[model samples]
Target: MSMINTEVSDFSVQAYVDDTFKEITKAQLLGKWNVFFFYPADFTFVCPTELEDLQDHYEQLKEIGCEIYAISCDTEYVHKAWHDHSEAIAKVTYPMIGDPTHQLARAFQVLIEADGVAERGTFIIDPDGKIVSYEVSSGSVGRNAEELLRKVEACQFVRKHGSEVCPANWKPGSKTLRPGIDLVGKL
Candidate 1:
């Protein structure tokens, strides 16, 4: 069940942002690059390290017009508590979404029903509210913010230059392959 290019459904959830609770809806995800970082839980090992790394790159991501949301099955209250207690989580300035009812987790297909948690899922969505890219991994493994940023940049570049396609490890200035029109559907 690949969710690629699937338009996000309309829904709203409470998010902890900048010392306050806010509602984040599908409408908010429109007209900009967005990243949905789904982790297992708050105050857990590995998750904090990943969140801190993401916080380190938050400014650069925003500079490129991308918004990030850290989501888990925890409640907004728990998210705030974690932010207040954990030094790593303390540095996060992006929206931290609480999906205790698993609405988001289920929609993202990252839910672990038995454990009442989510897998480590990272999704890159375009302004159209469609998922352009996604990756899921074991809870023990952490993701790299630098790589995620690169992917977002690449997605943006491709969106702007529809004829160009990014290659592996592609950066902004890197060369991209422009498939010949005759060869477009062969692969």
Candidate 2:
């Protein structure tokens, strides 16, 4: 089933952040934009690069009032270890959530039960806790954080201006199309 437009399920999990461990919950995500980034595991190929890429854009995402949460099936201890060892991961300021029981991965529908890992899943959730956009990709394929930021901008734009819609490759300050009878079949 499609997860788009669905409210995030109730969950409370431990997360490693800023050299300490803290608890995070669905309720905490309410009233702010959030990015739930799910990866397979820690200490693997391709994951660090993707995480660093996200770190590069973390400030921009925060400027737009979005908090990023990087999740994996690994435990919080593992997350901290990776952060300590990996320079790429060490630069990350966002929360790294530990889903040891796979509850989060299962809720996001990215769990690989056989392998006990999660697929690459990125979910953009609105302040109301409803998922507005999501992308699920294979484990081997890495995602671009810049593109995710663009989509968030578009989603925010459409939310504020209900009548207009962003077109393909739409960026901030770009023209948006408004659906109307006169514009039908014109494009």
Candidate 3:
């Protein structure tokens, strides 16, 4: 049970965006590339660094028609507090969702019950609300925003060129193999 390559239509969670609160769901994300980055909680170790890393690349992601969301099992008030306190988090202008009820975490299947926190789950959802990529790591580990950008590029490439597939570390203008029986084991 990992929720990979599945259509996520239930985006029934409230998100904090630019000092306001709004309900964000899959419907709002139609015809848009969505990046859902989950962390354990706010005001803790490792999470701030990762958020800052994402902050460093937020403009690039926005330019590529992708919306990035950082989520945790904390309240919007808590998110606001942390954002106000931490300089790194202060630079994060993207939507930082507060999944206190764990609805979104449950939908993504990354909720850790014992600690009431979410695992380090990253999801890349396409325009059609179908997940094209997902990565789940341990709670203590952080993620790389650079890799996420590369994956988005690959996903966008495949969407444009439906007959082609991106290979490992595939950057833009790199070689992509077309799906066919002849290509199997030929690499």
- What's the lDDT for all of these models? 0.96, 0.96, 0.90
Which residue runs does candidate 1 get wrong by more than 4 Å?
181-187
Cα lDDT of model 2 by residue, 76-97, tens digit: 9999999999989999999999
Each candidate's clash count:
0, 0, 0
Question: Is candidate 1 or 3 superior in TM-score?
Answer: 1
Alpha carbon deviation, residue 112, candidate 1 (Å):
0.3
Looking at model 3, which ten-residue stretch has the lowest summed lDDT?
2-11
Kindly state the number of residue pairs that clash in model 3: 0
TM-score of 2: 0.97
User: Which is better, 2 or 3, measured by lDDT?
Assistant: 2
Say which prediction, candidate 2 or candidate 3, comes out ahead on TM-score: 2
Tens-digit lDDT track of model 3 for 90-157: 99999999999998888888999999999999999999998999999998888999999999999999
Candidate 1 lDDT over residue span 56-93, tens digit each: 99999999999999999999999999999999999999
Ranking by TM-score: 2, 1, 3
Alpha carbon deviation, residue 76, candidate 3 (Å):
0.9
- Model 3 TM-score relative to the real fold: 0.94
